[model samples]
Target: MDHQLTQNLEEYSASSTTIKFDRPIPLLRAPSRPGLPMTLTGPYILAFKDLPSWAAAYKSCESKIIAQCEEGARIGCAITASNKCKPPWWQSLTGWKSMDLKERERCEDREMEDCLVSAKEKCMGFAKEHATTPFLDARIALGEGR
Candidate 1:
């Protein structure tokens, strides 16, 4: 939604090729549900019109990761606070003990990293299958040579 993001998407789209696809490619979009954590949203996958759409989708995916991480931090803080006091037996039995603060944070970080990696892989794979030259050239122009 930011101007910079829009500009980046426009630049990437403009620099990328204009190859036509038999069918529109699916690209990932952020979850529509309010307060729905990205972790529960599963993998990054959706539909896109062109390189600009792809760039936008990719940015959305990154935003989702950040949201998930922040949510995890909030949950961790709540758990830590509860642990400081006396939590109910049911709460204690909920398996929160199995994952300490560090472990939980690490798990969330790992999940976010995995999601981003998956998105990058999917993007690259799609470009390779559809318009390798344009995609690569745009990446190079954006100083993201590969």
Candidate 2:
């Protein structure tokens, strides 16, 4: 199969015009995630003796980060949506009325910002404790480091 694919690629590259092949060329599919496969590749087996443990830790961090971000988004959406409803009894009794549309939007924006900042802090704390070096390195590369 490898020989046949290489031959097909060579033939395709040599031809200037579109070349119709008798068989479809096979392509390599990337793993769903960016990390190495469950099994280590050649020459790296010694370095990854505990690959499963590392993978689990990486996945745990990933899940926690996703959950935190989702919660933040949920909180922001709830706040923005709640603004459309009437003020609570305590607030109404204290002369705090429901804000106008523009004011409500501003308030929502501020609340969302606060929620995201808190979420980020939580995620960073989790990463510090549970994430693998490579995972943290990647976050740093993406400008999300602590």
Candidate 3:
């Protein structure tokens, strides 16, 4: 057993409020197993103390969102099929004065801020709908450029 690895894992686990387990989480791994993926050779993470709660929370969060995520991902993929971040053709239209360009940029910034705020609020709303406690709230951090 790697004492350093166990100590590091313990240190990290201590910071999480949701999971509580024994001091030294018994780590187990087989060098090889039947039907195992070729890429999977790492130790299996096991924390039995509060597994039921964690599993239940994870399952609950996933159950309803399976279909929703699939559909949402499909729509999102379709919407961003051409993942180019280039400004719309209208933004590159005929020449304009500096003031006009600056004002347009300002308007665009405001619109982007508003959209980001609304998107985060909607994400939180969805989390709250399925979350019984703040600890159970699930969030996915999307890239700003995405």
Best by lDDT: 2
Each prediction's TM-score versus the true structure: 0.26, 0.35, 0.28
Clashes of 3: 0
Better TM-score candidate (2, 3): 2
Clashing pairs in model 1, backbone N/Cα/C closer than 3 A: 26-46, 26-47, 27-46, 27-47, 28-46
Q: Could you give the candidate ranking by lDDT, starting with the highest?
A: 2, 1, 3
Identify the superior model by lDDT, candidate 1 or candidate 2: 2
Candidate 2 per-residue lDDT over residues 1-146, each given as its tens digit: 69999887777674655767689553221122334543333222212223464466567667787687667666765666565443556886788766587876666677666767776777666656655544433311122452
Q: Which ten residues in a row have the lowest lDDT in candidate 1?
A: 134-143
Candidate number with greatest TM-score: 2
Q: Weakest 10 consecutive residues, lDDT, candidate 3?
A: 27-36
Report lDDT (CA) for all predictions: 0.50, 0.55, 0.48
Evaluate residue 24 in candidate 2 and report its C-alpha lDDT on the 0 to 100 scale. 59
Give per-residue CA lDDT, model 1, range 58-123, as digits (tens).
555555655555565556655554454443568667766533667656655665555555555554
- Give lDDT: candidate 1, residue 24: 61
What is the lDDT for 136 in model 3? Answer: 34
Root-mean-square deviation of Cα positions for candidate 2 versus the true structure, in angstroms? 13.8
